[model samples]
Target chain A: MSDAAATLKSLPQSGGFNNSPLAQWVKANLFPNWWSTVITLVLTYFILKFLFGALSWSLFNAVWSIEGTDTEVCRELKGIGACWALIAEKHRFILFGTYPFQEHWRPALLIVVFLVLYGLSTVRALWNYWLGVVWAAGLLSIGILMWGGVFGLRFVEQERWGGLPITLMLATFGIALAFPLGILLALGRRSDMPAIKAICVAYIELIRGVPLISLLFMASVMLPLFLPEGLTIDKLLRAQIAIILFAAAYLAEVVRGGLQAIPKGQYEAADALGLSYWKKTGFIVLPQALKIVIPPLVNTFIGLFKDTSLVLIIGIYDLLNAAKTSTIEPKWQGFSIEAYVFVSIIYFVFCFAMSKYSQKIEAELSHTHKH
Target chain B: MASIPRSRPAPPSIKLSLSDPVVRAIVFQVLVVGGVALLVWYLVSNTMANMEARKIASGFGFLNREAGFAISEHSIDYSPADSYFRALVVGVLNTLIVAILGIILATILGTIIGIGRLAKNWLISQICSVYIEVMRNLPLALQLVFWYYAVILENLPSAREAHNPLPGVFVSSRGIMVPVPANDPTYGWMLIACLIGIVGTVLLSRWAKARQAATGQQFPMLRAAAGLILGLPLLAWLAGGAPTVLDWPELRGFNFQGGGTLTPEFAALLIGLVTYTAAFVAEIVRSGILAVSHGQTEASSALGLKRGLTLRLVILPQALRVIIPPMISQYLNITKNSSLAVLIGYPDLVSIANTTLNQTGQAIEGIGIIMMVYLTVSLSIAAFGNWYNKRIALTER
Candidate 1:
């Protein structure tokens, strides 16, 4: 420490900034020797200037209240910011799509249930078998909320269930169900049995080769042809199946990568102990392999979450579709930006949080592995 | 322990039981085969019943029938009067063109950005990082919409207010206009010369490198190749002197004329697919570079090689083996995601197939064709990628 101090003391600096060594050095070397400091300041100044202007125009100088004639109200706040009145008039359609106006609370309730599930899952203490019960109960409650007929409730058709909650439900259920299917497929692919391995590989590669939109289209349009004459499937159920199948294929690959990374010695050790195949896998291999795969698995989940928006192509009014529908309303025809921005922020929040959580899990797993 | 072994040795042949390995294997095989057969039989029966009831024919022969819808863009000759088969071909070609061009552009852009993220320059690195973060976080479909509706449609100058560069080039919301070459014998010869020059330059590079290594003499390979590839082509064109005239887009009332127009949907889909895939590619490249050990760099430096030389000679060769596999997937991803063009009406293969299915009520046939096309494309890419990977892999053992 003294040697470093002596070295620092021996170094000369320009006599400026009250003769503080660091400040004098910065002023002389950073400011004078490099143009980067000057360029950075200039760029920062312009960026901040633009940001402030946009903020002022979008918020401070904006029309807040829905009052007067449309043009007149906007004119009244001429120097003010954005006309948020369009959103006020059309926010319901954006939130609930073509669901009955009075029944908007049903979808709203469903959204709350979803939020609770998401919140609970984020807490480590709550991530247990009881939480599984909570999730199952919550899902049932949401279903009842959306489609009422039990316990003196009104019956709502699947067609009427639209907007953000439906999107989240499809993605969440798809991922949950796909997780087990993916694990089975991954194990089957790695199975010593040739028939099982071939079947698993074919299923995974066939599904992964095609785009989700095509699969969704097949599910929506052509699935009925493959069903028995008397059997009929709901459109939403078919879309859910497509989502599950697609997610499972991608997730299976991620899981397979993890399984391959587990050393052969683990399997040999399990065999040496005379454990049955199922016991060996269930008690030992899967836990360690899954820990290795948390990052990629989360990524696959995020991909599926974002991909739920493709349901809109088959006329399922998901969040983006709902937003589009809202923007097309005569009262809010030109405010598509605000509606899109709102939906994008919702998606960004979910996806960003998932990735950040995945990173955290990865760090923890690596830390544990090292010791 | 010895007594138990003697009991097994007493048997003339290996015994099989329900719990034994052979019986278990046979039972499992029979069960799997039976299950698959059952599924196939069920599906076939159901499909026949549905087709009989709906009176919808289920053969690919319908492809020969006329497809009456006009396509927005085509690289080859096509018309509304053409057969569904022809229309499908046009769609497939369009998909390939976009996928190939997008892959090339994405690779170039991704490598640059990936390296820039690791550069000593702080600004460049930060800018690249920010780009990756924002793009990777956003849903590609949303980015497509933003590019289409907000950036391209809102910001592009109208035809009346078109931005022009030089005499013949014009830019508008409609499309970019540049001089298109007309048919001429002399120009054809010049193109042939250019092709020859390209091949010659490649051969000359190999020869130059070999000579430099053998004789301890440096070769000006870049300059020589540049002269052969560019100068020869230019000289051939100059000798022939077949002047090509510019055919500028003229404003005919409201719309521009005399040049090809890129539809907004196509532009949006192309940009989105390339940018989204490029982000993944950039991450792959960054990881690939990191996978090359610092010891490799130190070793090169100790051998008195410059930084650039070390990177090109030692690092990139190692990094590429890591990079290529994931990069191939990213390419495949870009190709597959181009199917999103259906949402915005870009008329890709899936869009054309949808139209075909809707018009003919041939759901099974249309879907089968679509799946087959995608399967073929995927398998070909997988095969090529594997072969390329094998070539680049280090023989460490």
Candidate 2:
């Protein structure tokens, strides 16, 4: 028995090819058949080639930093390697736009405030009645910081504001203002009243049927035509209104989805309680409906955030515009790839974070609903 | 007027006051309608005042005037001397070209990626997931600019040194050029043959289904359909004398001459739109496929159907019911998002309209035309989706 035990221990483990889990996994997944093996080899070849190419171009061969818009190295690397030196040189201008280089700290600080507010909102526990107060205060600060004329801080005009802060402002204000209007529209769309429903349907469909670019074009050009003579709306403000209107229409549909998902019994229960229309919707219907739609609401916000880039077309210098112009200087002209990549990463970070958070909330919501 | 045996008037059940639901609803509707009309009236009056001040014409009469601007790419014959209406048509055609091609390509690529997301191969799945996430997260505007500036303009060689990855194809910073059939009447005949084949196939399939139900016998429908479609096209092409000559692009002076050209702007727009939309399409497809239960596969397999047959008859038909409604919306998204062609200087509807608006001071008319075209297209897509959804929806007694 002792001899047999020793022999067994000495022998190689049966059915273990090299005792490597990775090799076993590869065998099962990558090369289960001759056709699969061929695919595996081809895909591996191309993927490896691309991976190395991108890695070397972006990290290994790239010129990372240059002093004060200097030339030489970046110009030589041009196509072979990324010119990240341009990003370091023009990052401030790309982030803050033409908001007076000396007052850069103001936008920078406001960005910090925005971050803090976003962080606070991201926490699940803080999602209560106080959320409104936090947002109101946050937005008010944004306005004050942006147009500061008091407290020895210089006042920056709206036109001078651009880049990351402007993107943040548009997305934030767009969501903030649009959400209530969207709710109202959603309610109107679902109302028993025919005339009300018709008007709501027409407005929502009219806005949804066209691209946001058309509305921006309307805001930039035709909005003036709809204004009283000799009176003017600021370009940024007009764009903001367009964004709000566009977002409200889309959000209304999303909100209507939530409203539809609510059981008819809930509406009946509210009605049975002798609640007035406003009281019923406000206390009972809307709270439950809005909660069900939070994930999609976040998703809509992401779309709006990405869409803010389109403001560049109408000459509002948002982040994309700032990035585009960063490379317009003669020395930096050919280095748009770097600038775009930098801004894209910024956009990606914000959007990715929001999307991931939405996914998390969606999972939680489904889990709770299941329970 | 009190009739014989008329019951005493039912005790006034519903109060005729603001507290009553019906009364409140009517009041709300009237208030909303009045508010909307008042707003519209205010805007219209303001607009007229502003138009008078600016001396801007409001109607589409400008569409008849000479465009006085050249559209670099157009499917139909057009010139700088063409009317603005003709120019708009060119823009619309350009938009349709990109939108249709984008939809087709995005669907193909998206379906592959979507399937790959559930692949047994770990590396392939991971790669596909990464592609979807990265592409989906980035702003499409940023992607379009990246394609335009970074890929096309920055890296591509000049016209003389254009890369030719395939025979009769050339890619340069200026554009891509591919050979086209040299004025082929034979191709049109082939197209007509293909159409006939499609109709015949449909009829054959209907007869096969009826026969199968009647006699419990199966027909080789797939093989017959393929032959009728592909073989008939080939036969027509041969009968019409297959034209071998192609209008291959050639380097002459600075740019490629002859052949068909896809401008850098168009190519970039197509690439960006397709790539960006594919990510979302992939997610939709993945969800759709997942929505079909594993039990379905097992049930079909137990019934002794081959894998491919099971996929064709059982899996796809079910998955498509879930896939199609979302897919239609995505197609609509492509059409709408193609408006971004304005930025990269593609002569899409929006871009050309912007130019016309600038030249003629017809901003309102231009914007109205754009909205009307897009709204009609959007509504049509929605209607088609609704119809298709009804057709595919499961029915019961």
Candidate 3:
């Protein structure tokens, strides 16, 4: 009886050709039924076809070098695949539109510096009071680098600044300036003071109601009309301010959500400690509220990053606009698709990374706080 | 040694003081209000001076002037000779058209994809997730540009080489021309029949519900409603001398003439807005569905309800409560994002106002109108959402 049982047990788990985990997974996930199997097969066919087509187009037929070739070479391979040659040739113009070619290294260096600062800020170990100092120093340095006059570098005007650097500048500065304003607005909205509450509500609603494009238009056009005679704000500055105002409203709402989540006990305890309103908020409430809101804050940051593109409407030469302007060249006229795709990849990388970071933070926070 | 007892401090006089919370609050409010008032005063003075110096007339009076620029797409009758106000009205209508259509399309697509995300089919779920990720990650403006330039203009054939994918329908780089129904007299009757059928469906469903409550017997309400709606419309059309003639688009030398055409700009904007907003809507829907507790489903099933009936009767209604608030915001988002139609030269409100602003140099007035319109739209959606939410909200003591 024991021998028979052993033999039966050793019969490869009963089902034919389903002994392997791969087969088991396929059966369980892909082909649990006739309908599922049919769907899997059809989807697999189309997906594979698409993957192969994309691969062949992007890799096999794509022209990689434009060093020794011209537009004619790209034209020859036009219908077959993407003209990557166009990206290679005009990448400089696309990166630093209207900026003098000799000074390309400045913007390039600034981009790297800003990226490094961003990376540093993301490290949990770097979360301290000094981080604010670091950001301030970093932003100042970037400003000096972009505007150049103090350090004996040539003065490149704001008009000449473009590409990735400008995109980063607008987004980073907008968020940096907006964060404190957002916190204030959140507090004001929740405060017992009626006048303060009303103003905060109105400001938030007004900004939230309109599209960012309208604000950009208001900044670019109406802002000039509103300013004192002969007192001017640069197009970039006005756009930046508009972005700050718009982002602050959204951030305020998020912060308010975080604030509302804080327990009444926390407030009562702070009150019992004889803490003043400002001290109570700063020490007792805001830290915990802000901590709970980090994920949403990051999401807002990602949104602000994407929205920096809207500055293109008001004639700011951000990365997207730079790419677009590059494609306007006669030699690169037909390669807009390639240029846009490249720019899109850059944006996608930044946004995806930020979103992933937010997810990770959310997971970590939840894990630590598991009941 | 025994210590001498200290005398209680004398009560302080009740006086108006900054230390008092009530007095401090009043002071703070006055200060804030004063600051705001001063800021407003400064801004107005500066604006007035700037306007005077630049010789720029400010106000709504300029809206009466001729627009002097052509709008490519307009819902209402418009010409370059039309007043700026009329041009703006057309722009608002165009904006409304795109926003409404985008909201409808996005909701449908989003709901399907949202449900698809929860499907047991692995390939389908993965595809839906991928689509959501891609559409969400990209900026709406960039996507609009892509749809306009790459998808529509570059990939589509020119008018001369228009692709006739369907009979009486022509798609080209210029636009998509689809056969529309002729302005037949019978069409009015057919539409009226549809309205009647809809009313009948509602009454039928109500009666069925009441009967079920009283008799504990189920009715095939869906089939009956569908039959009424479809059959009545068909009968009306047939009775009114079925006007089957379609105004087919005919390809002239360089373009399709006749029939309704969806301009490339409109198409691109619609597609981009729908796809982008749908990603967000899908997430909202998924979360909303998930918010309907699993116990509810188990309980419904335990009561001998089938899967379809349980989902329809138990899950969806509860899920909709969680879904709607965010869904309204998404609708508002679609409306606002439709302003990006300017990027592709769609004559949306923002685009038309932008041109008006440029031509008339009435930037303040132009921006004011745009802001007011958007605010009105946002408020209206919020108010409607609030009403619906209140209606559907779970009531408890």
Candidate 4:
């Protein structure tokens, strides 16, 4: 009875911080020791200093707006404060590049369609054959929304496409096209057939060895030469193809990791059940492998999304290019700082959301495994 | 049971039908190879037709032609009058400069930040976490432009108003200008001595390690290595009369003329790549350290090992096994990413090749050159990584 009482008494002290008061928690975490206090004090000073400087520059002393494209107000406060008037003036161009000004509603609506598709895809219950059909429908509507010639809607050539919609298209289409190709490549690399394995290895390695810019340069400049006479691909399509091919190589490696992770017994079990290679892989192997690899696939997707910005190098105006163009105008020439900051926040938001989601999923996966 | 004679089933005979796996494998390989060959033939024929129609010559002969355009920066002496090959050499060297410096700096910074992320101080860890996330989530290209436009070009004043951030270092829109050692032959001897000292230190460590295994006695190996590395170089410098003259940059007409300078383009590219890559490196490092199980540290502590010895003998070796492969890939990433120098006009290989392709209209050859150079570098690094990994791999037996 004495021993039992002693064990019970020690439980609360061992689980110390679970229901502790705020002051105790704060003292333990933030100022647990002299060194920690020193760190907290130093970090607090710098953070406050930066916050004050940034607040004054971006909010307090900023030029919010100027009437009628006037530069005098912004020019006066060039270094002293932010010229958010530039962002307000150039947000349209930055959001939707050379697309017809009157038809901005289409791209704007296209952005909404993308968001809805993303939202649908994110829900766990929707991950089924219906999801693929939904994606197909979503992609078709995306095409129609981007290029309309029927139903009293004006047709807009892809040449005029730019900005955020283009960024999304490049990233989304890249992943959509690359995922299957990556799976096939991964399967081929693991196959017993030497020729197929060699081909897959060669493709993946050649694509991955060089930087994306080199491939973009090839797609933009050399791809024309490789095509038949009188046949030309549009710049955006060419860049999109390059992105698909590049992303597939990286995705293939990730999938290969998943493939390697499967125990030999699983493959043997499927084989003993009289399943053919394709049936076994598609019905059994892939389901388990892809499930295990989703978190890493999301990481690859984050990379792909960021890589879409490189399309600007080939003069296919993506978001970064739009921002650069916004600054080229005489009115907004010196306000690229504001332009970049604005665009960076957008990019950051997308990337951060994806990374957080990926982290959460990974944590859940590890949790299940632990249990 | 004895009267029943059981006949063994014959092993499955090979058949030419699709049901036979051997036959299927052969047929599949054939079809795939044939299809690939057909595609290659078609593309080649098309390329040939297009080249003839466009009247564009396809050969490496253009490499010998005069590169009429000027490169903004070059590691070696280069002129507009130089051959295209020489210009390419300059660009390759420039790319190497960024790769080498970026790798070194990123490794140092990433290790520090990674350790900081695990600090006992909650504020320090939080600060490190924020730094990694913010640096990583933003696109590298955007960061490069910001560094070029907002930080370097816009914020820095012109040459006349160059700010002295350090004792003899100047920052301006023109680029960074800092003091350089005056032309002295003694520095060359010192550099050679430093190289020799490095080699000597390696030999000393091998000997010390063998001695420790044999005698179980510790040697002051670090002090001995340090002395060899530093003392030899210092002795060489002292023997050469210890010249300490420096050529400080001065405002001459419109620019600083006397010192070693970093072009704005190079500075932007380097800073962007190093900081961006450091975030990735930090994550890899943290994960590697975390991969070392807590039980190993406890075991070492229970064995009466000091904290430093516990970490060195138990934790680090295991952590390194997880750390090295990813760390190598990060190095590879830095090398590949240095190609982004084109965006900021750093005159790297891609930029130089782009100019060449435009000037000579040798698209196929230009692209071929780029792929070859990158492939060679990449394969070499991969090969080296495999070798190093094998050397450090655990002996299971």
Candidate 5:
């Protein structure tokens, strides 16, 4: 009987996974908690129902490749599946709106170039300080390919450039130019001179307060008024400048957060070493501040990437605009869902990657700083 | 050393003139000032010349002229005959409406999603993660257009096939319709009571908080405050119940009459701004909650504080300080984004300004007012944010 008691006491608690009693209880009583179990069961039922319904509509019953009118086919498949014919016929317009049909490959190539450039930038081994070269080269190649005035390709006007390439260019060029401008503005705001600081503050505040739409409106309509006669600026250039200015304002604030976080002693130390203002800033202050702000900086970049779609408001045919224009065609009018879904997927992929990249960088930085 | 400065006084005299530090500082200040002044002067001269040659007059005088255009959404009584200045004010007010609404909705949704993201349930967190990731990455403009076209516009029944669910409510491809309040004189008093209730509740909440701090006892402040605010208004309404009447919408043929209708354009713009801003707010809230160290919560729990009470008293105050600044920027973003109303032809400030500029050939004046209005609104928001931030900021000894 003593041995039996000892054996009973020595036996391990079944299904014990966690040290905490609550965790252990949850593990042991998986579906034993009445309210939670009911909720789980209900949720599971609904989720499975939704999954099956979606599968039936989108996969099993969906028209995969029917070469006929969507109206007739979709009516037959009503309450059964998605009519995907709209996307099949109108995808070209959605991807490369109003571009010459024969020259669609140019924009297609531009997309590949952009992806490759971005892919290269993501890898730590390839992300050299001088990787600006790759971006510059990529931008040039994209511009030439899309605009096509140089090196045996037909000249395409800025007006004709549309779709994803425009969106990518706007974001890429905006960041490429705005980052340096933002750093300078941030430095100026933190400068000893009151005048420079005040000016920087005014500029940043003014640009940041207004929506990107207003700025685009101003760029498209009012920019010509501010320039000299016959020195006409391209609409694309005007939009680009506006985006750069607007992005710099927001980026400056992010960078300033980094600047504020750096210890004052570092500045004093650099000063104590008799380094000049530019020397100290270039070597000490900026590098540290930039490093500290990478996550937020990348956040801003991702934001700008998404925000580039606003140029469509000013009649610049960007990716969103292209998708919109595609949907309005008589044949594709009802296929709005397919077009939007396709574009949303593209945006999701790019955005998700960028966000993950930002997270990874943040984790690496935090880990290194801890040691 | 004894041989080297023999001419200098053993007890050195204090020299105030032209020290290296002073000289250097003076030179730097002068260079900076002079350079800025020069740049400003150049831009000014260039701008003046350009404006003069273009025959564009610059000033606030045109503001008093008749606007001659109707705005789609106006909070104030306005007409096409109203002054341009008043029209701009209408636009500004409209912008504020969108911003405020977006901020409130985003905050509630974002908080819920943020907490949901950290929930113990696997399904809840996974759903939240997908929502955040998907929404955060898509361009807000595209989303807005998609919502407008694919969801709202396409799904709605056509005008002839209108869905009238109630006597005073109508739904169709055009938009939703609901009864408007009868223009009653008692509304003025209702407005006054609302103001009083707001102020009284604020004061009472403060007093209650002070009382709680002075004593270890807790007050049911939220319930009490809610009663005071709502009950007072209800009492006022009952006392003057005979003063107002309902204005029910009536369906005339295929159209809804005698009720306010929400145009698809306005609905789309509002929806876009809210959803887009909500995504950012979700991330901000999640980060804010995560930022509060785990130890703080553990400590609160260790003291035998209830979960609700601990969240109300301890975690929230700290999280709020982190949350408000970003939330303010999101508000600004929403305000600015409402200008996208122009795309679908909602007569927002930018659209109105664009129309005015196009019509009167007063591009400079029209654009200037737009810029100034935006600048003012933006500055005010920033100022308010800074003030609120300072108020809730943690004090360190």
Candidate 6:
């Protein structure tokens, strides 16, 4: 027993917690030095002041209900808070734009469906051939709902379809269609034939050299001129095609980066096996190259999503346009801040989720590569 | 094995021309080229027919016609009487102004934020991360609109309630009016002095480098260069009467008069572009800095170098190699995105061309001009980037 006691005395002593966890954390992280302490204090004070001011403006003094012309209430509150009642009064118009009032449910449901499809896609277990089928079916259902000509539902022109549904459809279709075209273009760029290579290079560079706004303008203006008389296409379709072509060029470059990363040994091995060219590319090469490029591919998708908002310039009533239009209501003329904030939150949520998903996929891919 | 092979090797049969891979490839190429040519021909013919039917005379001739539109912000003197070509020039200049200013501001802000992300202070780093995430995730167009309508116009006090926040500055919904120097003839001499100072600084820096190599002595090259550039210009200005006349804006009627104005549209476009692009630049910078292995810092420290010295001598040179290429692309992106200025009525090239096209029914020509301008800008930036990249690339002998 005496020997044991002596051994215990020789062990390192723990500095038994003299301070609380919060105090210790604060000392270590924020107040390690005089300058750090000052900086921390000053920054914290300003951040809190700003936060509380925003909170009070957005919450405490904000008018919540659409009762009466609540413009008076907002004027009285002045700079103290937001006028949320403006959003309340204009939410439907902001969400659906010129879509028929009673049929607002169609777009509202389409948004939920799109969200479900997005969620489904995020699940690793659902990543199979069936996923493609699901996407196709989902897109078809969304189309039928938006352009109702069957089941006794009223027929709505594409022109009448606006707001969030249009934004979702354009982005989804743009990325989906661009993917295959991008792969083809990437392949063409890497081909041995000079003619094919030149054409691909020219297309990619020309599209990438200009802004999406210019392309949209070309679609809206020049496309009609190029088409024969009586072969008119919908304006929305024209913009959608422009988006597809523009995205394909960017995506082609990204895919080319992945293809270049692949080892020449893989191609040589497949050739040695006497695999046909298409078989080799489709079965042996593409799977690995595409897997390697998933992160960048998702990044391109995020860019495409943000870019879809530019359709507003071409007079498309996308989500941002709808929100902007809502603010023009005489009753809510100056309350654009609230509407913009709401729309920004929606964009932020989608973009942040996509970025996070890409990061996660990148981490997983690298982890798998380690084995 | 050779004897066995000699037993029965019938003269190699010539492959059928139809089955030959070379022939197949040629056919495929011909088919693709022919298809593309056919499509182009079809488009041209259809366009011609459409133009004939619409009675729209198509050509570049419209460029010489008068552009009867007033541009709000122009770097050059522009009037409704100006030809469309001159109007387009003003538009291009306006685009360049925004791009140049945006590049400068974004670089400054992004570098600061990027360094802050790696700061020893946890709160500072977190704040910087949040700022980057929030700024990057939102659509730039939305941000531009919000900045124009909500942040600047709605929030600022109207002209009737204008306030002088600074000695010679006025803030109102009309715009932020600030004092500017009157155009003086002696300014040209000051500019010449500045050019001379720049040349002198370059020569001095090269001399300093040579002296350091020859004699192992350190010179304060940066301080000396700054003195030459700034002091020479100051002395020249002083010699030329100091040109101290200020054009301070005064509240006249419902507007401010007599000073340069930063219109709300310009302010909004600049802020939106800078903040959005800065987020991307911050990530590039952070990644570039991180890419320089941590061992570099430790090695410099082991050699007894101070922190700032280590960063300057060991870290930045390596980080810049990684930073520059992406930074070039960001610059190109900024130039291209400046087209979005039209959303807020900033009369950029696209906006001006759009108006011209609407007036002249020259959609094809208008779009073609816009494309050519953008392509030229893009190609120039890319060419410059490639040259710079080659100069800085690692020389692996």
User: Could you tell me every candidate's TM-score relative to the true structure?
Assistant: 0.90, 0.95, 0.94, 0.95, 0.88, 0.94
> Model 1 scores what on Cα lDDT?
0.81
Q: lDDT tens digits, residues A1-371, model 6?
A: 85676566446555655355775677678876668878998999999998999999999888887566658878677678798887788788777889999899999999998999999999988999999998998998898899999987799988888888888889999999999999999999998777888999999999999999999999999999999999998889999999999999999999998899999999888877978779999998888899999999999999999999999999999999999998786867788899999889989999999999999999999999999
Cα lDDT tens digits, model 5, A288-312, are: 9999999988889989999998888
lDDT of 3 by residue, B1-397 (tens): 0011114343476668786666788899999999999999999888888888889987799888888999887777889999999999999999999999999999999999998998888899999999988888888888988889877887788898998999988899989999999888788888898899999999989999999999999999989988889988899999988888889899888888989999999999999999999899999999999999999999999999999999898999999999999899899999999999899999999999999988888888899999999999999998999999999989989
Summarize candidate 1's per-residue lDDT along A1-371 as a digit string, tens digits. 85676567557766755477776555544343235566556656876887798898678777666764454665455434566676676678777877888878888888888888888887777766899999899988988888899888788888888888778889999999999999999998998778888999999999988888889989988899999898999988899999999999999999999999999899888977978778999988998898799889988988898898888888888888887677564555545566677777888888888888898888988899899
Model 4 residue A134 lDDT score: 84
Chain B global fold similarity (TM-score) for predicted model 3 against the true chain B: 0.91
User: For each candidate, what is the lDDT?
Assistant: 0.81, 0.90, 0.89, 0.89, 0.80, 0.90
Instruction: Write model 1 residue lDDT over B1-397, tens digit each, in one string.
Output: 1122344545577777675555676688679878988998999899899999989987788888889999988888899999999999988988887788789988988888898778554555677887787777777777776677645664567778878876767777776666566555677777888899899998988888899889978888779888987888788878878467545567898777775556677777888888887878888999999999999999999999999999899999999999999888887888888888887778789999999999999988888888889888988998899999999898887
Candidate number of the best DockQ: 2
Worst 10 residues of 5 chain A by lDDT: A25-34
Per-residue error (Å), model 6, residue A84? 0.9
Docking quality (DockQ) of candidate 3: 0.51
Error of 3 at A79 (Å): 3.6
Minimum summed lDDT over a 10-residue window in model 1 chain A is located at A25-34
Residue-by-residue lDDT tens digits, candidate 4, B1-397: 1111124343476346775566668888999999999999999999999989989998899999999989988879999999999999988888889999999999999999999998877778888999999998889999999999878887789999999999779999999999999999999999999999999999988988999999988899879888989999899999999999999999889999988999899899999999999999999999989999999999999999999999888999888888889898888889888998888899999899889999999998888888888888888888899898888878797
Assess the local accuracy of residue A41 in candidate 1 as a C-alpha lDDT between 0 and 100: 66
* Better by DockQ, candidate 3 or 2: 2
Give the DockQ-based CAPRI class for model 5.
Answer: acceptable
Worst 10 residues of 4 chain B by lDDT: B1-10
lDDT of 2 at B229: 97
RMSD of candidate 1 to the truth, in angstroms, is: 4.5
**Ten residues in a row with the worst lDDT in model 5 chain B?**
B1-10
Docking class of 2: medium
